[model samples]
Target: MLNDFLSHLFPRVVLRRNLAFSYTFCLGGLAFGAFLLLLLSGMLLLFYYQAAPDKAYASILFLESSVWGGGYLRSLHRLCSHTLLVLLMLHTLRVVLTGAYQKPRHLNWVIGCLLMLLCVFEAYTGYLLPMDQLALWATQTGMELLAIFPCGPLLRGILVPDGIGQSMSLLRFYALHIMLVPLSVMGLSFLHFYRIRKNKGVLPYL
Candidate 1:
């Protein structure tokens, strides 16, 4: 039924794939699967976390020290996030080098670009979730870089909450890490993959 709908909407959908599997899907699938793993780990962490300052850090400690498999889950989440960033970058470069950005596939090109940006955002926000010294310094650096914009105040208003303590930033980061960035990336990913099917798959050179 899904195939039929796709065929009606995009005649090239059926033509997109060769009788053999696509190499692109292999790479994309790995990145997407890693993203799912990160999400799952994050959700499990959420069950044990409290957003408040005193408890938030304590919760992570508890996860590491007391909870079985907690350390492994945390490490897995970090690794997957890093892997997703690398894979997405490689995937984008592969698409671009193959001339996949031309003609009817230009929209997909734009979607791919947005996904890359979102991936970076996702990584930056997620780095702050652990609330460690490294995370704090990294977030501070990120904020400084963001403030370099001519519209620094406006950007700060959105990215930083005024008068609140350190936890506010962590909460903000966690929200974007878990929610906004994922939604945007996931939506654009659907558009990007759909375009691949619509355009009869990646270009031969691509």
Candidate 2:
């Protein structure tokens, strides 16, 4: 039954030479793998994380210093998040260079672009959750940079209500980083993969 469903979603030709499975150098699969790693590690970290401004940093410290494997999990999460960005960019460049975005694949290309942006946003939100000096200043600087845009104030308000370093702001970032953004990314990833199959898989190797 599962095989039939998958076969219905993906043509046999596409499945036979799946880009995700066959391409040795392509980083799309690696990006997806990294995302999965981030998801698992992030979930584990959540058990020990505190979203309040006062406790956030201290909790992280405890997690690292005391909790078994917590430090490694956090490191893995951070590493995968960074690695996913690089791999996604490389995969996108490969697609563009191969003219894979042409014709029926245009929608999937657009979806991929949105996924990349969401990945960046996910990373940014998580960055602020650590609530340390670096996270605080980095988030503040990011908001300040956003202020350069026409609707920067509105965007900043939406992202960091009550301003940076505040409890509410930390909570907002936590919600987005852990729940909303990840869910949206997962949904888009499903659509992106489905579209790839619908489009009869990736472009031929260039």
Candidate 3:
């Protein structure tokens, strides 16, 4: 029924028989489902989440202790982020093991990889918003790890001009987490979906 509706809207759209439930495991679909949950919960979080360094942790505490269901909402967001990353990895692995990354599907494979990276980056940005001890130490450690990369210092400077756990860094992470990264992910996801739809289905093994 869902395929029929999509086919009605896009007459050329097709799903080959090989796209059976067992073969695909619907990993991509599950990842998108997790993304949708994260998007919704994160948006709801924005209503009460203060990005200021001084109030960041306080805001989280307030939400958890005061707002009904706020803690559960935050937990859901965190869980979905992890779930999406895991699902992406599984999806990528499945593609590799099945040779789905060959020929015309290579572009979509790259998009999938980019989506995974974007999701990881999104998690990193969100990890620091709480401004707690663990967040500070973890972010500082991540920056150190990043510093070892080529042009790492330059990139780190751009990401955290005032240093990790500082006001400026908090604001930067907040902006990237809430706006930039999400927009990039959404745009790339659209491209990925379009490519898949255009290609119709995984091509027969050459």
lDDT, candidate 3, 1-206, per-residue tens:
34533442356634565445576787877898898899999999999999998899999999999999999999999999999999999999999999888888899888889999999999999999988999999999999999999999999999999989888889999999999999999777777777776676555511
lDDT string, candidate 1, 1-206, tens digits? 35533453445634444435665555666787788788888889888877765676788899989999989988888899899988888888777776777887888788788888888889987776666778777778878777888998677767777522266766787788878888888777667666666675445522
Q: What is the TM-score of each candidate against the true structure?
A: 0.84, 0.88, 0.90
lDDT, model 2, position 54: 85
Q: What is candidate 2's lDDT per residue for 94-155, written digit by digit as tens?
A: 88877888887889889999999999999999989888889989999999999899999999
Q: How far out, in Å, is residue 66 in model 3?
A: 0.4
TM value for model 1 = 0.84
Best by lDDT: 3
Candidate 2 runs further than 4 Å off: 1-24
* Candidate 1 lDDT score at position 116: 83
Candidate 3 runs further than 4 Å off? 1-20, 201-206
The candidates, ranked best first by lDDT, are 3, 2, 1
What are the lDDT scores of the predictions, listed in order? Answer: 0.74, 0.83, 0.86
- Worst ten in a row by lDDT for model 3: 1-10
lDDT of model 2 at position 111: 92
* Model 2 worst lDDT window (10 residues): 1-10
